[model samples]
Target: MTSTGEGPSATGSSSISANTSQISLADQFARSTEEEIQFALDEIRNENDKLEKETGILTKYLKRVDPKDIQTQIKGLEASPVQQDVVRVHKRRSRSRTGSTERLLKLTTEQKCDIAQREHDELREEINKFKHETEKILDTYRATREEAEIRLAEMKKSSYEFNRDIVLGAKNLRTGRVVAERVTRYFEDKMRSRKALIEKLRLKNSTLKVQKKKLQLQLKQKEEMGEVLHEVDFKQLRIENNQYLEKIDERNQELLKLKHSSGNTLQVLNTYKKKLNNLTMESNRLKLEISQRNELLTKIDKETELVEKEREKAESINANLRRQLQDYIVPEVLDYVQVRADLYELTKTMKTWERKVDIAQMELQKYQKQWLMMREHNRTVNPWATMEQHAAL
Candidate 1:
């Protein structure tokens, strides 16, 4: 029996050891998983950094080639006269005078060589410029490709991280669920006790809810009663206010009557004031007319003096005219005709000035009438007058 028990116990011990080993192995695997994820993240960061450095260097190299230099070289090549041909004609006549022979003079060998050398230099510069530009373009394209690759790698790394996080979270959730299940299994007695307590709490909550509902109903009833009371009070207050307002209205009616009477008195006073002002204005106008009459008398005195002088001048002119008539000059008739035409033009100018004055006076009278009508309308609809009535009330 001892041997049999030992054998069974040994088997049990082996099983326990195996289980411990499995747990350790799982722990090691989890640690390795975390380390591998960290390693992957680091590798991605290092790769990204390397790609960025390379891209930066390539971009700098591309920027070093100036496109303006290439354009300037092209322009210089186009402007070079050596690229164009000019023809010159030479004529030679023999001493025998048979005819003229025309020959075209071409550029000399040295000149042609110089032009070719210049052309070669221009072509070389253009070619070199184009080569540099092409290299710059290629460098840019390569840098762009590298940047895109780097970005793609970064996106892949982020995707991997996201997937890893989801996996880790799921694992943690599963572990939590296992732990929770183990705790529930270990505390079955306590769970029953807690269940009873929860049931009691649920019953208590239900009862409390019913009590709260009853309280709410009571509160609603109280609120309704309070609202009814408030309404009754509001109605009573409104009735009282209405009675007071009626009395006030009666007083206001009396006040309005007084105000109307006062307004009538003010209107009468204003009318008397206006009449007094009109009388004063008439007196002032009369004074002004007297002053104007005096000025006119002075003007008349000056005109009399002027007319006297003009008459003397006319008499002298008449004497000269009579003398001229006696001389019997036909040119004198032309002078008399021009004098008559000038007098007619002066008379027409005076008539035009008089017509303009009459038109201006008519326009002024129309404006005055419009202004007076607008004033009367404003007095009837003035907001200030209404405000004053309200204030008095």
Candidate 2:
């Protein structure tokens, strides 16, 4: 039996080995696929970097323009006054045919000066206009510089935010990949284990089926032997039946005696039932008394609850009264006492102020007396008659 079991076990193990080999092959395929995806992502990143650099360079070139250079070129064109002078000189020569060559040449100098002066005035006006225009250009350049600075700041901030998001996204992607890989590996391993178990079960089932066939053959052989044994048992059962019939007759007599005793026992059971009925009535009476007591207890509980509620209400009222006494009565008394005390202190202060005023009056009188005495002394030292004589001279 052990040898037979070993044969099936060996077959089951072989099936598991085959399944594990297939799972290993599948794992290799998955790893290869991941490597390819990573390579593609890296290539795309390189291309994106190259494109961004090119775009940045092109944008800088397009924005590069010097406003001062444009202003300098316009000023140079405006400064050339030679053409205007030549035109004025030719016109004068054409109009003065009777004039001498020296006179015409002399007139040319005066005309050139006059023309140059007018050109200078015009150029000054143009310069003024250019200055006004250049002011506007400078204002526009300043605004553009500010806007570009703001845009650059915004772009840098956006780039930082985008890079942060990219970093977070990359981290999430890496984490997801790791989790997915682990899950895939776990499931693959589970599937391999299941396949191995299923193969083992299949082998066990096959062995069981073979054992069932063998059991069926053994059962057939046992059935044939059982038929002969059953015939011998039948003859013995017939002999035993005859002896059992005699024993049953004796048992029937004993049953008759038991029936008589049972009838007497029935009478005793009826007597006990009467007593049980009386006890039941008493028990019912006691149950009614208990129910009445329970009702009384319930009523008492309800009254106690009412009393408790009233006590709580009284406590709340007392607490409210105490709070009202503290809020209104005590503070009002204290306020009145404080006001009386302040009035008494104010009265004392007024008395002290009156005494100080009287002392000040006395000091003022003493000063007035001294001032009068000094005036008398001054009059004696310098006589009024001498002062009047000096004033007259």
Against the reference, the lDDT scores of all candidates come to 0.69, 0.69
Q: lDDT score, residue 209, model 2? A: 100
TM accuracy, model 2? 0.19
lDDT per residue, candidate 2, 242-349, as tens digits? Answer: 889989988998999999999899999999999999999999999999999999999999999999999999999999999888887444888999999999999999
Clash totals for all candidate models? 0, 0
Candidate 1: stretches off by over 4 Å: 1-103, 171-393
Clashing pairs in 1: none
